[model samples]
Target: MNKEWFNSRAKINYFDKGYLVICAVLSVIEQQSPLNSTYR
Candidate 1:
C-alpha cells in the first residue's frame, strides 16, 4: 500500500511539472505575440 501511494504521488508530481512547463511555454508565446503585432 505504501509503495502504491508513493507511485501515485510521483506520477502526480511528474504531471504537475509537465503542466508547469507547458504553461511557461505558452506564456512566453503569448508575451511575444503582442510585441510582434505591434512591430508589424
Candidate 2:
C-alpha cells in the first residue's frame, strides 16, 4: 500500500473505465449511424 503503487493502480482503473465508455459510445453511434451499414 505504497502511495506510488496506489496511484498507478488508480490510473489503470481509470483508463480501463474510460476505454469501456468510449467503446460503448462508439457502438451506440455505430448502431444509429446510417454510414455504418456500409461496413456491415
Give the number of the best model, judged by lDDT: 2
C-alpha RMSD for every candidate: 4.6, 2.8
The alpha-carbon lDDT assigned to residue 2 of candidate 2 equals 100
User: How much is the lDDT of residue 7 in candidate 1?
Assistant: 100
Residue pairs clashing in model 2 are none
TM-score between model 1 and native? 0.76
Per-residue lDDT tens digits for candidate 1, residues 1-40, read: 9999999999999999999999997777678988647655
TM-score of each: 0.76, 0.73
Off by over 4 Å in 2: 35-40
Each prediction's whole-model lDDT (CA): 0.87, 0.88
Per-residue lDDT tens digits for candidate 2, residues 1-40, read 6999999999999999999999997898798767577556
